[model samples]
Target chain A: MTPAVTGVAVTGVAVALPGAADARALLHPARPGAGPVDPAALIGRKGLRFKDRATQLGLHLAYAALSDAGLLQNGELTVRKDRLGAVVSSNLGNVDTVCRAVETISKESTSALSPMDTPNASSNIIASETAIRYGLRGPNLTVCNGRASGLDAIRWAALMLRTGRADHILVTGVEPDNEVTRRLVDGPMADGGAAVVLSRPAGTRARALLGPVLRTAQPADTAHQLVRQVPGGGLWLSAEDHPVPRSALRNALNSWGELSGALGVVQCAAAAGWFAEGNKSPAYALAGAAGAVLLAPEGTP
Target chain B: MTYPILGTGAVASIGADADAIFDSLCAGRSGLAPLRAFDPSRFNAQQLFEIDDRQTEGIDEPGRATRFLVEAIRQAAEDAGLPEDLAGIPVLVGTGLRELRTLELWWRDGVPLDADGLHFEDALRRHFGAVDTHTFAGACSASLYALALAWDLLELGEAETVVVAGCDVVTESMFGQADRVQFDPPPSVRPFDENRQGTILGEGAAAIVLSRSAPAGRPVRGRLHSVAVNCDAHHQTAPDAAGVEDAVRQAQAQAEVTPADIDLVVLHGTGTPLNDRTEAAVTARVFDSPGPALTGIKSLTGHTSGSAGLLSLIVALRSLERGLVPPIAGLADPLPEAAELRLVAGGPLAAPLRLAQVNSFGFGGVNAVAIVGGAA
Candidate 1:
C-alpha cells in the first residue's frame, strides 16, 4: 500500500562509528579493533554519568543529525518542539543497567541500588532521554523488535510524518556492546549509533527519497521480489543472510560488523550517502528477515 | 477508518480470558494477594496480582511472560477463526520488561539463557508460525503504542489483519525498586483513593486481533476508533498534565468524537498520589463536569506494566458490549480532584455504554490513549 504522505525525503544523516566521519564511511569495512568514540567528548559530560552507553551514543548522534538537518541553531531546536518526534531502535540498549540492577537486588537488597540509576534500567530510557535532551515533546517510540527494529523505526517515522503527526522526525538506531552484551552474544557486534532526519519534501533539500517499506512474513520470497525491483547496476544492501545469489548484493553486517538493531538505519544512511554522491541507481536495504525498503536519489521517479 | 476488533484474549490474575476477566470484574473479584512470585520478606510491599498456577499449568514452560503471550495470542487467533499458523498476519507484542525476569533467573540461578529468547520474536515464530513479529518496549504504555501502530497499518491498507499483544512479568529488580521508592507499604492498589499509597506491580498478558473488516459468523466485539500516543518529555518517571491532555485531545479528535460522545473513560490510574492528581486534573479539564463514568482497572489488576493498557482496553470493550462498567474495587474515599468526575464504585454501574476511552501512561513520560465503541 502506498503511504498517504509521499515524497518523504531524507533531510540529513549522522553516524557515530569509531574512526568514521560520516555515513559514507559505513559503506566500507571498519578498521580492525575499532571501537566507539567517547560520547562524553561529543555530547558533553553534564548528563553522561547516569546514562547507559546506548543512550549516550544516541544523544550524540541525535544532536549531529538535527544539526545536519539545519533544525538546530546554537544548540536549540529551530523547529517547534512539539512538531518534532523521535523513534529509537535498540535490542540491548540497557542490558547492562538492567542486569546490574538484577544482580544488585539478588546479591544484596533494594537499599543497595542507587535511586539515580533506577530510571536507566527501564528499556525506554534511551528514547525518552533523547527527547528530554532535545526538548522534543512530540510522539516518542522505542522499537526492540529484534532484527527488523531499525527498519521498523523508520517505517513508523514515515507513517507519523505522512499522518501529519510530526513535521520532522529523528529516527535513531543504536546498540551497546558491553560486558553484558558480550556474555549474551557469541560474536562481535556493532557498538555505535546511526540517525536520519526524515521530513516532508516541501521545504527541505532532499538527500534521498524514501520509498514504501514492505513488511512480510515470507523473507525469501520478499527478498527475491525486492531484488527484482532493483535495476541492473543498482545497489542492494542486506543485513540478513538470504538465499539470493546476486554478486552485487552487499552484506551490511560484513562491512559494518553485526549491527543488530542498528542495521537497517545504518544501511539507509549508507544508501542516502550513495545518493548524495550522485549515484543514479536505485538502492534497497533489506533486514530482519521480515522487511525491506527502497531508496532513490532526489528527483528520481 | 475504524478497525474492527475481531477477537481478544487476556490472562490476568482475575481470570484467564476476556469474558472470564470481565465477569470477575463485574462480580467484584480482587486479584491482589500475598506475593508468591518471589520472597515477600525482601520487599516492603507484600502484595501483588500474580497469575494463579492453575491458570498457567501447562503453558508456563519457556518463560512466564512468553508463555502468557503465546496463550493469549492463540486464544485471540482461535476466537477470530484464523488458523493456528498465522502466515500473513503480523504480530506486535509490547512489554515494559520483555525478559527481565528470565534474565534475573539466569543471573541468580545459573540458568542457560539463549540471547535469541530475550526478544519474543523467536518464541512467537516457534509457537505460532508467526514469521513477522514486532516487539515494542515503550515502558508501561507499550501495548497501546503497539495498538496505535497497528491501527495505522490497517487504516493505511498496509495489512488486512494484525495482532497486538502486551505482557510483562514483574521482576525482583522492579519490585525492589518500587519497594525502595514507596515510603509506605500499601495493602493494595487504590486508584483515586484519598489514602492511595503507590502502585503494586502485576503479571499478565492481553491480546487483540484487529482487521480491516469483520469476519462472517464471528461477532465484532468493538470498533477501535482511534489511538494517539505522545511523550511528555517532562520527566523520566513523573507525568505532565499538559502532555496527558494533549494525548487525550488528539485521540478524541482523530476519532471525531466530542467529549459528550464518550460514555466511559478507563483511567490509567496507577494509584500513586502524583499520577492520580495529574490524571484527575487532566480528565476534568478535558471533559465537562460530572463527565463520563470514570473507572480504573489497576485497582484489581495491580498495574500489569506494559499489558495494563490493553487490559484496560479490553475492559472498555467489554463494558461497551455488556452495558456494565466495573467498579473500582477497594475504593472508599475518592480523591478531592475526582469530585467533579464520576468515579465508579460500590459494584458495577449498569448503563448503556457506547463510546469509551482507555488511557495508559508509562515511564519516560509516554502517554497513549485509545477510543473504542460498541458493536452496532
Candidate 2:
C-alpha cells in the first residue's frame, strides 16, 4: 500500500562515486575547489590519494548533493546539525580496511598490521564518521538490506522525516567499487555513491512542482526476499499490461543474485541521474533492494 | 500506544517450534541435558541446553540456530496471518554474536585463519527474501534493541507491521569464553537459590510478528504496554544492583503503569552470585505488597546469550495464555526474595492474572524491561 504523502516532498538530490571515471574529474580539480574540473582539466590530478575509495565517494556525493540544492553556503551545509539525520548505507563496511585487518590479525602476525585502521572497518563507522564530520545529531543509522541499501537508505530517511525525527535527512549510499566487493558480490561491481536531501512537509520548492509521491514493495514469491534476493531478481513484469520502461531495467536490483543490495544503491544514485534521461518523458527516483522503492515524478502512473 | 504482538516463534530446550516448546514449559519439563554436541569431551563442563545432536531424530537440518531462524520466521508469518510470501514485509534480526557456532566451530577451529566472519549476507538474504533492512546489533541487549526499533516504527506509523527476531547458536568461543569467565554451573542451573552454582550454557532463537492491528484468531497472548532499555556503562560483565531498579522504574513510568499493575514478573535471573542477589534486591523494592508472581526460564532454556530476552518474552506470553505462571524448573529451595512471588513449581497455575514484566539485562549494563498485561 502507498503511504499518503501527508504534505511531504523531495527538495533536492545529488550523487557522487569517487574516481568512477566521471567522479575522478570531480574529485581532483586543478585547484582545490575551482568549480570541479572537467575532462579537459583532469590532467593535473592523477595521484591524489584517498584513504579508501568508499570514503572518497561518500564525501564527493555528499558535496554534490549539497551543491545541487544550493544548500552549500560559505562552506556550511544548509541543514542544521540538530534537525538533520544521516543514513550512510553500505554492503561491505570499508572492505579495503576489513581485508587488511583480517590479513593482519588472523593470517599474519598481529604486529605486522598497523592496528590503526581497525576501528574504521566497523559497520557503523561511516555513519559515525559522517555524523562527526557534519554536526548531524539527528538519527544516525546504518542500514543493510543487501541490494536495497540505497533504496532502504532513502526509505529510512524519509520515514524519519515523516515521523518528525528530523526536518530534512541526508541519505547517502556509498561502496567502493573495489576488487574485494566485486569478487565477494560475484557479479558486476556496483562502484558509486548517491545522496538525497529528504525534507519535512512543505520544506521544498519542489513541493510546488511535485505531483504525488508513492512507495510500495512487491512481494517475494518466497518467504525470504529482503535479505536474500529471489532468483532472476524477483518477477519483473515485462509489462504487456503497462509497457515496462527501458529505464526500469537500468534501475532494477530485485533478486538475491550478485550485487542485489548494491543494486539498490545504484538505483538511488541513478534515480537522480537527470543526464541519463535526455529523451525520456517520465521523471524518476529509486532506492532500496529487497522491497525495491519506486519514486517517480509526482503524478506518474 | 500499545503495539500488538500479532505473531510469535521460539527455539529452546523443550522443542524447536513454538507450540512444542511452550507446551513443554507448561508441563514443567526441564530442557537441560548433557553437552553432547560440539564434542564436550574436550571441555570442562558437560551441561548445556544444546540442540545440535537432536537434528537426526528431532529438528530437520542445518544445526539448531539456523533452523531456529528459518522456522521462527515461517511460524511468525503464519502466526501473524500474513500471506505465505515475504515480499512486502520488513524484518529486523537481533543477535549478540550471529552464527556463533558456525564461526567458532567451522571458521575458527579448522579453517584458514583469515576465513573468520566471512560474507554473512548470502545466508541472511537467502532466508529473509524481501526484508526492509538487515541489521546485526552485537550488544548483549541486541534482540530487545531490535524490538524497540520495531516498536518506534509502528508507533510512528512508518509501517503497520514488523517481524523481529533474535538468535544465537553454541560456539567454541562461547563455550571457551564462558568457561574462562567461570560462568558455568555444576551439572545443573539454579536461579535465586542460596546454594546457586553458576550459569549453564544455552543457545536458541525467538521471532515475533508485530503489527499496529492485532490479529483476531488466537487467544490474546499479552499486551506490551511499555519497553525501556538502558545501558549501565558500569563494569562490562556485571550489573549495578541499583541500576536494575532504575530500569524497572523507567519502564513503569514510560508505560504510565505502576509496579502494582504488574501481575507477574520474569527476572533476568542469570544465577550468578552478583546477578541473582541483585535481581532479588530489585524485585523487593519494586513490589512490596502482593508482588507479582516471579518465574524464570534459565533453568529450562539455559542461557541463549543475546537471544534470551525474546525467548523469555515468548514464555511470558505463553504463561499469560495458560492463565498460570510456569515454575523455575531447577529452583528446589528458592532464595528469600524469590520465594516472595509465587514460584509455580511442579506445573502452571490459573489465576491472579492481569500484568507481567520480562527483564533481560546483558553485559555492559545493557538492560531492557518489557511490561505487558491484559489491560496493557
Q: Model 2, B1-376: lDDT tens per residue? A: 6767877888776787777777776776677776655444345666778765464543222334556676777787777777766655667776654543443333223433121133233444466564454454333455665676677678776678888887776644445445434534366777888778878768778888877877565544466777765444344456776657767887788788888888888778877777887888788878876677888888777877767888888778877776767777777777776667556565676776777888987654556788766623
- CAPRI class of candidate 1: medium
Using Cα atoms, each model's DockQ against the true complex is 0.65, 0.07
Put down candidate 1 lDDT per residue, B1-376, tens digits, no spaces.
7889998999999999999889888888878988765655566677888887634432222278998899899988888888999877989998998987887777667677856667798789888888778888999999999998888778767789999999998877777777777768788789999999888888889999999999776788899999998999899988999999999999999999999999999999999999999999999999997689999888888889999999999999999998999999878998998888899999999999999999999999999999999988
Top model number, TM-score? 1
Which whole-number lDDT from 0 to 100 does residue A158 have in model 2?
63
CA lDDT of each prediction against the hidden true structure: 0.83, 0.57
lDDT of 1: 0.83
Q: Put down candidate 2 lDDT per residue, A75-159, tens digits, no spaces.
A: 6767665566666667664655655543433453333444334334344445544544444545555554454455556665665
lDDT of 2: 0.57
